[model samples]
Target: MSLQIYDTKIGKKIPFTPLRDNHVRIYACGITAYDFCHLGHARSALVFDMIVSYLRHSGYKVTFVRNFTDIDDKIINRAQKQNTTCAELSQRFIDEFYIDMKALKITPPDYEPRATEHIPEIIDIIEKLMTKGIAYQADGDVYFEVEKFPQYGSLSGRNLDDLKAGARISINKIKKNPMDFALWKASKPGEPKWDSPWGEGRPGWHIECSAMSRKYLGDSFDIHGGGEDLVFPHHENELAQSEGASGKPFANHWIHHAFVTIRDEKMSKSLHNFLTIREVLKRHQPEALRMMVFATHYRHPLDFSESGLRDAQTSVNRLYNCMAACAALTDGTESSKAVATRAEIDKLRSLPDRFQEAMDNDFNTAQGLGCLFDAVKSINRISQALPAPPAQADINLLRRGGADVTKLAQIMGLLSQEPQAYLAGYQEKHLTAVGMDKAELNKLLEERIAARQNKEWGRADEIRDLLLAKNIELKDSQDGTAWYVAGDRGQ
Candidate 1:
């Protein structure tokens, strides 16, 4: 079946036909890098991550681009508050962004361009808009004239009159209408500045994505995604500027993930309700966070609550427990693996169909997760009946199941760590004390084989306990036992 995705512009599910065959290009509006990453940012990251993961798993070459708005009001103000340059401050947050994404297991985008890094691209786009008469210079600032673009509100479904009414116009004497947004902002003293036809200034938030998307992807791309809050003014203006400048459809599909609310209220740093990934990881496993985020559909609002997380934790634990039991089971007959293999294959084959179905319908993550949970159950059941170390056939099935889980989880930025590591409170010291490091743990585990083969159950159990005490957990397979360190398992 064709991969179907909901097109935000048309508000319907449509087959994804890439501009180029066997290839997909995606653009996700990345964070502004002004503050610590928040749940809202996580949602956007995960949303597109899933899209890319599924596309690749489905055998398409995916070029994913997620940009950083390294220059913005918040970034400038933050730098000033910290008594630093905008570039310095942005660099700090960029580092933090990577750390947070890594902790959440979010795959790095194929191209992670920064807005400040793409100044030339932004200038070229502004030049195009100027030549097309879609944008004009006003008081040394380039602004896209709202009225000049006939399809100005087509994406957001609001006309110029309604937009003018709803928009909050500051005391800007040069703007012809309140709805007119900036393509470029004139630089202020002490702020980051770039040389442009409009003087030393920076590109506006909307223009950066359009410019970066065009530079890295093309005049048109397959999907452009961001948070729902960006639907207006941000994403809306991106459409106006990109299509208006290029005179081509900017993107074939637009996907927006919903916001995250805390305690049934809007989450704001001012409200002190903003939940950072670091903060969340303090109390829950990364996989738990993944499950929590995916419990609801990407296009729907997700409420943040302690109770909700507890539920997710419970669910992930159940899956792990089932897998552990499967690993522990020992069936005498070799044919046991073959029987388990057939069952596992059936389950694996069914995964893509259901997962795709959910993703096709507006990126319905909730439904996709439902399908994933079903697959997890099937895997656990097959494991229960498999031979010890699982028949070579069963071992293959286990690997496939692991891949299925890992693939879906990668899209959600979850489960990148070894399962055992995730369950143990792994630390660097413990990793080193294991007489091995992450890179060497697999080989060192071979030494333990002799003890187990010698039927030194007492010695083998001691080694396992020692590893566990050091925040490393082991999973014994027919081949051998492997270990992982759990990063965030308890609060």
Candidate 2:
């Protein structure tokens, strides 16, 4: 089946056809690099990451570009406050952004261009717009004449008269139109600037993406995407600047992911409720955060909550637990990996097709996760149904089952860790959140082991109940007592 995605420009779900056969080029708007990265940033990064992952998994060669807004008004203001240069401040945060992304296990973009690095490209676009009469200079500042481009509001769905009525005051008094936005801003005292034909100034917000994308992905690319908040002024203005300069389509399709909200309100640092990736990682594994994102469809708003995040941690625990079980069931021997029977592993064999069906529909990770958990359930059932000294054929089937489930999960950037290692990390984080340490857990387990050895059943049960109250679960087998914080375990 062909891939389908919702195009924000056309405002409909359409069959995705790349401009080049078997190749896809995409550019996603990246961070402003003026502050620490938050969940809002995480959501956008993961959304695009999943899209790229699925595209490559489907055998398409993908070139992904996510840019950095290294030169901006925000960067200038923040630099003056911190007593640093715009270049230093912006690059500092750019490094911090990469740290956060690495902790989140985000795939590094193929090309990470910065506005400051592409000054020449920015100037070239502005010169083209100026020569074509699409943009004009007024008192050292250059503004795009919205009235000059007939398709100015096509992407944003705004009209001239309504927009004029909505804005009673023009941001720049000398501009020809109220809705006209800046292409180049004249330099201010102590602000970073590059010498240009328009005088000493920097590129405007919208113009940066146009120049960076054109330089990296050409005048027209297969896809352009970002957070929904950029649609109105940022993307709309970018669309105008690129097409107005090149006289061609800016992007073949546009993909916009919805906002991440907290308590039904949008997540933002200004609202004072934003949680940074660093803060979240201090209490939860990175894979847990990735799962929390995949739990919701990209086009839908993800209502953030502490409880919801904990649930995602629990879900990760279950996935890794299932992996551990499958491995334990089958000894890693050549005979154990041989094909058992077609009927024995039929459900396991159906993963790729089942997963592709969900993802092919606008990258529906939530539905793809549903398929994932169903396979998890199937393997778990197989593990439970095995006899004490399992037959060779069943071992082979279990080995195949474990490998198949892992392959599918890895596509969505989950279950990439060794099962034991993942479970240890997941348990440690939960342990820290609950104000307990693994040292304490080990001590308690030691005491319980003594109680069980003495055959003091009541004392042993009391210790188990005490740990259970702390959300730590336990299992008993011939190997003795084994426990991890596997969540509430259905109470």
Candidate 3:
């Protein structure tokens, strides 16, 4: 199947061939940089990160740009509340955003333009709008004239008449029309200001993205993306400002990921239900959160819940266990003689193709993840059937299966850790979450081993019950005994 993208502009899935052959230029609207990133921000970042990964995996040379709005109303207000300069506050949060993105394993875009740094570019675009009669200056402020651009509402799928009907009467008397938005805001009491023709003022929110994206990705790029919440005024105004200024199409395709919600309500400060990325990271494995995000389709709402994260942890644990199992079977001490069938080898090798097929059809990561687990399930079943010290041919088959699953999983930034190391780290974290003393646990394990070795069955049973009561599950095998955190991790 040809790669397809669900373009929010045209409201349909289109066969996505780039504007230029063998190259894709993408620009995504980044955070405003006033606070720590939330789950919604993480989803947007990961969604585009997946897109970039898949495009490169498909042999497209990609140049991706994501811009930060460093000067906005929110930043000004937040700076005041924190008793700091807007630049200082924005920079601090941008640093925090990077830390969160790193923890989530998100790929950074090639160019990360800040609005304050691109003041000249912003002013140039605003001037272009003014020259084309698409913007007007009034009382030391500049506003985009929505009526000047006939295709104003096309990107957001809103007609002009309907928009005008639903539009509320703004209290601002300076704007020509109530629907018109600011291109440049006049300097406020203590907010950051820049010298522009409109007066000493900073660029407006929507204008910053248009200016920065053009500087990095040119007048027209292959793809533009953001959260769906940006579709209406933000992206719509950006579309109007860019196309109106340059008389060229701004971006060929537009993509928007849906929101992350809580109890069917969109995340907002008013509801107090949103979780920051670092906050969530403190309580759950970062990889587990990634799994949870990919479990749902990008355009579908993913409800935030503790149970959902626990389920994700279990799923991640299963995938890693599958890898660990393959490693053990493929250990070098196995029999060299070919004593097993090869029926499943070809099926195992076909996993990467299966995953790519899912990714090709509208970049369906949820479906792609399903393809990954399909291979894991087969490998697990085959491993269970094989004998101890399995034949070299069977071992070779397991190796191939493990290699195939790892190759595909990397595209989604999953299972990149060495199997044993990840499992061990998970155990350590689980140990900490349960408030179990590691040294004490080790002492108990040693004592239990001594009891088992001495055939003290009753004492061994008592120790086992004690550990199980604390949510530790024990398993006995030829290699000896091992334990796992059994129930709700509560982290």
Q: Can you write out model 1's per-residue Cα lDDT over 254-355, one digit (the tens) per residue? A: 888778898777676778889898888876667777888888877778998877887887777665554444444453445543655465578777786777
Q: What C-alpha lDDT values do all the predictions have?
A: 0.78, 0.87, 0.87
Runs with alpha carbons beyond 4 Å of true place in candidate 2: 168-171, 331-346, 391-393, 428-447, 465-471, 486-491
TM-score of each: 0.79, 0.92, 0.95
- Could you tell me how far off, in angstroms, the CA of residue 429 lies in candidate 2 after the best superposition? 4.7
- C-alpha lDDT of residue 89 in model 1: 89
**Candidate 2 structure quality by residue, lDDT tens digits, 390-417:** 6676676667768877887887789989
- List clashing residue pairs in candidate 3: none
What TM-score quantifies how close candidate 1 is to the native fold?
0.79
Per the 3 Å backbone cut-off, how many clashing residue pairs does candidate 2 have?
0
- Candidate 3 achieves a global lDDT of 0.87
Candidate 2, pairs of clashing residues: none
Worst 10 residues of 1 by lDDT: 328-337
